[model samples]
Target chain A: MVLKVGILGGANIANKISRAINSIPDVAQVVVVGSREASKAAAFIERNKLVHASPVAGYDAVLDFPGVEAVYIPLPTALHVEWVQKAASKGLHIVLEKPIAIEDEHVDAIVKAAADANVVLFDGTMWMHHPRTAAMEAALQEIGPVWDVDSAFTFKGSADFLENNVRVKADGDPLGALGDVGWYCVRAILWAYDFTPPTHVAAHHGALFNEAGVPLNIAATLLFPGGRKARFLAAFDTVFTSKLEVYGDRGSLRLRDFVIPTAEHEASFVVATANGLADGDTRIATVEETRTVRNAVTQEAALWQRFAREIEVVRAGGRAPEYWPRIAALTERVLSAVLASARQGCALLPFEHRA
Target chain B: MVLKVGILGGANIANKISRAINSIPDVAQVVVVGSREASKAAAFIERNKLVHASPVAGYDAVLDFPGVEAVYIPLPTALHVEWVQKAASKGLHIVLEKPIAIEDEHVDAIVKAAADANVVLFDGTMWMHHPRTAAMEAALQEIGPVWDVDSAFTFKGSADFLENNVRVKADGDPLGALGDVGWYCVRAILWAYDFTPPTHVAAHHGALFNEAGVPLNIAATLLFPGGRKARFLAAFDTVFTSKLEVYGDRGSLRLRDFVIPTAEHEASFVVATANGLADGDTRIATVEETRTVRNAVTQEAALWQRFAREIEVVRAGGRAPEYWPRIAALTERVLSAVLASARQGCALLPFEHRA
Candidate 1:
């Protein structure tokens, strides 16, 4: 059976999802596109040449479509809580783009509603579905117990994404850099490091020049229960770069240019190990192989296909994995820490968990 | 009046002092050069082609050099405490290389002897001599009360400086990274943030390869009194990279390529601040300047020349600044935390000052 989806906002993410849904094998169909203005939704369909769609105004019309079984939310951050709750009430499975909500209460409501409705709910964190994530993780494990995890994602800017656009809003402000890129780094650590919840979270965030820079760059450190620690940095106004290195006892695993992967190949962390104590006995550690994929485009396509597989799991009368709620909770937890640190101008310790 | 000096080792630092002492107008002769091996000392003298008398064989020869009122200790990590104490007993003022000792006892003895001798003792942390340090600090002050300071120093291994070489033997051992590059990054935070001594210490360290492999890297966070925090990453088995960034309420100040600076001149940090809601103007608060030095080598030369200036203060018979002991004490304190974390693989809270 096909899962017919209605996109609730005509945003860039909607375009990406339309492409993804079109590519996935008989899993999802984008039947309707809705915006506050009918012309806007119609324009999106016309521009993308989306053949199968009902151009509608307001979210209710999208929900009223008989074939729409799931809702793909690409609305402003502030609208997530309301729409996700509404979609759940209408018995629609949901895919909410990160951050899910700007405030904790909004996230709380959405999480509780999804739990009560017993429906599939996932945050559109694309990298989690990337094939290379598993390969890089397995390679890291070969090195043994991880001692440190560090990540960085930096870029000069996205001028094209700006220019009086959708994220440029009053109360519907775009999430800060931490909310955007930092979330990915946080997820990368979560996935690699046994999905441990951070015991202590400390963060530093700052604005940039363009697009009402919402904490465009942030640096945060998460301390786990064991002496294990992870540090991450995300930025919009820095030179283009992203890397993840997991330093372990026996060796280390590194993914250079992680967030913005290169085409046709992958990079590995150069390893070094001791051979023996005798003079001239030492040797450079072996370089293990990592799963090489194409660019971010292919990685994204691979993940969306996997997510489409999970749609079958959702259809089988069970439930989507709790990974989505857990990720939602963690993102909120980290974002809260960043805000507290920003307001206080000092490290916030014993970070408050979402009750 | 000249402040006569004698050298006890032929390390690279000793070469730097030769140049500084030769160039300074207030300096005297390079009276003596001593090493455990006579040929090695002679080779150093021949390489520099100095006017000093023949290179001496025993440690005592330099201790007994005529008119030598001060000593520069640029020897191996383990040997620092012994020489500092011996030099102190002989009433010789000293400029000690960093990691004053690989072990706490070594630092304790050096601190005690310096106090007992009523003579000047300085750690050769020459990066402090860079004018930009003061500039960065001044900018930090303007930003508001600081909450976090992040620092890193990493570089590819120098084949010539492999583990077990006398200079790095102790530091290249299982937990060596804690005392080697780790000390500098730790000190940068302690000094930059002026954080109080920690009450507890925890660390996580492991072989970049295995136990027998050299400890090539360390990542640790220190918690100070009153909720202040500092985090750092230091390594000898990665790319040559260094950075120092301080986060405050109003904005942040960052210095890129810190350990080994770049010729582009000024190190930069983008200070981000949010405009009022009405203005909707958020941008980097600009404060740009050029470093003006060629590279790390030239920058290092400038640092030693500044070290010579401190000799002027010593010549005046004044006590060294209060910040010195605090900086030294914090280094040992944080290193202890790093070691503890490495041993236990958990975040150690509130590092304690060693007894």
Candidate 2:
């Protein structure tokens, strides 16, 4: 009953997923590892200690493998549309990395192909599957209505990474920091609003670009209906930071580590009650409460578990989950809008979904 | 010798300043209280336990009172220019409440009047005097070049406050939340950048306005020259949150209570080192350090002591302090640009300082 997962690239993230799959032996297993070079794929498997996975000569060989029921694509962003479309044509379930496509049309095509093939699809945003995320979702409901959200994800890239990494190349990953680090910030904001897309998007000025014209640092604001707003920043030149703040009418939720928890087994977020001046006093008094959630499995492993469950449901003659593709599409739409707005001199752009 | 001070307007904030003045009895003393109604001024003196102060019928009376060398003006936003000009003409040192004026022209008039009379002018943003703020400034230098700053200051208004508070009225406090709460966020951003104003400012969409066409909630982004940026949120309809995050190339600094510390005597901020995967490991390791500052005096009392010292220097034939008014004018210029951008449909406005 194990779901056979195939990896399409020898990317660093592929090694992480390979480990995650091996950790959850009851539900899923990595059956094939593919790369442009057979030697590279072999080395990746040997280095990761992926004893059960068989290294293949080319990406197409994994797609054409007889025992592969699903594929995990950690290839460069520019290659996502072609591989995802091909995987969908072969009726393979997909665990795609973020920044799913460089453009919305490609995302639409991949989504339509998956729908046509009746296959399960999920993005590789592992934090969404954590039990702590569920706890945070419940806490938000208790706090009255949320009105504002601020999130950021940043990291300092090494000199070699800036000079040689495919992520900084225009043709390799056109969105650059907007696609790598910014993808998480966009997804986090959308999740906080229950997958509601923004009505308006505006890129802030002062976005830094590389020699080839790909952004290295950027920020944007998303405006939703009813005075709800979110602001996010993404950078490849800053020290590592992952934080999110959700402000409600009656309370607030703040977490210093939202994209990736500081600890694997335990995570915590702070909730503050409405602030006010105490009776006959000028100083404000706000009561803060900390909430924690613990899980033995890593968030990445949990993500694979959920994907395996969805695959099982589809195999048993059930419909593919609509929520997964829906959210993925929304994330791409907002990101595309941000890029367009930034290109047009930081103008306010209307957010429209093709689907 | 004690510097004799006068209180102009019976505003609620005046009560807080009166207490701060009394706490520093060795340097400054309140000699007169002024209001539109003589009876109201007398009642305020008794209610606030200002036993050493005399009540005056009119604001002009406080300015004319003999031996009054300084004045603290806590009048409504619309009345700042008139009282500040009169007090300055009397050669009085002034402690002005924030949101100095509704328009740039008004702020210019006050600055000119103060300069003409050779008076030491200081704004009543008390948190700037906290010892922790100095410590934070030092930490920023250690962290390397700061490129991005995010700050917020929000508080929930009571029902009576929403309906009857002068802050919500167009003719009384006009600037509304942007002038009241947003003033702090703007100042913090400027301070973090060492008083260098942004080259461009843009108001984020989704600003909530009251019935009187004044903002109740608003957010904006400021872009400095070298890809350095700042974003801030100010709201009157949400729980109080005074947070600041500063990101640099080598590290980051974050604090939950930036506008007002959680306690009068102690404050803390967290610093995170640059993250990286440990040698031969896949997990990111970021070290977080907490820093605390303890003080014997409240920030407000410390602010008063500094203002009193500056007055003493001016009284001894020293030149008036230019740094105070210079920073004040820069804060107002950024605030005014935010309002202008919001009014013009979130347009990107150039930040121009008259001073």
Candidate 3:
């Protein structure tokens, strides 16, 4: 009774998730691969050596395939709304890749369709499922209420990538760098704030866009109630890094490899505790040390395993934990707010997701 | 040949620098300590064990004291311009504590008067003189053009301190947490940007103020030309921490104890390097390692030593380097812009200082 999963499109991310799914052989398997062109999908399966999966032409074929309980949609940002609705209609659960939808309205619609079909809908945010995330949360409890977060995820793409990559093309992934790298930054801040809505969203007034008007670089600040604030920076043309610092009333946690660990075996973060002012109130007395959390499998595999369990629950006629879709929808809501702020000349706007 | 220095006010920071100055008997000594009340100045000198210094009843007495070649003014923010001017008229070099003035306009005037008197005017920014700063600058070179910076300096103050501390009073330091702690945050960003003025400044909406309207918490963004930017967070009611990160085109640098080291004998920072994309572009390849920079004395002593050297040149009839004053003026210009943005309903404003 392996949870059969289908891969849609020959996206670069497909190879990684496919391998992750295959690793959890007893729980889930990549049962099929789908693409508009069958040859491209076949080439992708061959490249990743997905022996348990077969290739089919057209994305619809995967939705219609027998035993395909879930479809991992790695399609471009613009394609999620259509394919996800179709996949949900076919009663298949979803493992939609990040920037799940380009628009916030589309996010609610997509999630609602899945709920109507009684299928689990989960965004492919791998880090959220990692055991280290739980560890970081446990550490955060020592720090009291988190009031500040600073995060950055930037990658130095090839010159050709900035010029021609689908990520930077308005028609392909309209959110561009904001949709690509910034997705993690936004989620990290929201996670630190425990999913509470920010009162104001403002961009840093230094966003860069491609010729197609896709964002290449963006920086934004979110101000939550109770004087809590978060700032995030994302870029496609800058140095590669994933950094997060969460400061609370009593302590702080810093993770340099937050988005993706330097290695898959373990992840580490620094926790700093201070006794406050000392030495004539000129030097702050602080004690900082690193703590590591190790996982038996990679974070991506953990994500698949968790999603597979939810599918198992649904197959057994039990509930599929509704928080998954709720998190996805909330992340999309905040993501839209940041995009709106960036598009509106970096104006400060209220983060209102209710329609 | 020792540089005889006069201390203005019994401000908390004065104790630190007086100890710093008294440590180097060959280069400098605290010749006089001044306060509106003589007992307070005498107590400060006794507490800091400034054996060579005597107490004076008024600030003007120190400026007029025989053989006092320089004045270290750690008075409240509102008193700097008046005392600095009076001291300059007496041909005294000056080491003024940070948040040099309540307004940017006063910054130009203070520097202009110092230049006119041919006196060395160095701000009491201890970290600028630390050897770790030089090492950090050298490490930043590997990162290429720094495009982004994030820094924070915050302390969780007691209830009494927040209510009664002069820093929270409009007449004492109008800048409050911003002036007291954010001065370093602003200077750290400007230093990362090579003292270049930002084109725009905007503060986060989460700023908190005391009864006197002095900011207790503030967060801001400074946008330079070419889309380079920096974000700073300062607070009086948070877990104590001083963190800095500079991201450039090729790599990044992170310093946890950037404002004040955990230990005076040594300081450390992390430098991360990335090879851009890896694992089918799903994971970014990065390597981060920590580097330590040790100093023989605390940064405060180093600051006083550097300022004493400048005073030595002035006393020797050689021209003092003018860049120190320039950096101080530039930092004040940016600091005022952040406060203005915070006050103007957190509006985004141009960072203009030319008047």
Predictions in order: chain A TM-score: 0.86, 0.97, 0.96
Give per-residue CA lDDT, model 2, range B1-355, as digits (tens): 8889899988988888877778888878889999989889999899878878899999999999989999999999899999899889889999999989998988888888888888999988888898999999999998888888888888888899988999999998888999998998999999889988789998887788898988898889998888788899888887888878888777888887777777777888988766554423334567878999997787888888888888778878988888888888889888889989999988888887555
Question: TM per model?
Answer: 0.61, 0.97, 0.97
Off by over 4 Å in 2: A277-282, B275-284
lDDT of model 3 at position A23: 75
lDDT of 3 by residue, B223-302 (tens): 89987888888899877778788888778998767877777788888888764556665555767778898898888889
Residue A184 miss distance in model 1 (angstroms): 1.7
Docking class of 1: incorrect
lDDT of 2 at A202: 88
Cα-based lDDT at residue A53, candidate 2 = 84
Worst 10 residues of 2 chain B by lDDT: B275-284
DockQ per candidate: 0.06, 0.52, 0.58
lDDT tens per residue, model 2, A22-53: 88888888888998888888898888787778
Error (Å) of candidate 3 at residue B285 is 3.6
- Fnat, model by model in order, equals 0.00, 0.44, 0.58
Model 1, runs deviating above 4 Å: A1-61, A66-70, A74-95, A99-149, A152-182, A187-230, A233-355, B23-29, B52-54, B158-163, B171-175, B205-214, B264-309, B320-322, B347-349
Clashes of each: 26, 0, 0
How much of the true contact map at the interface does candidate 1 reproduce, as a fraction? 0.00
lDDT by residue (tens digit), candidate 1, A168-226:
34355456566666777877777667777777766532223234545655666677666
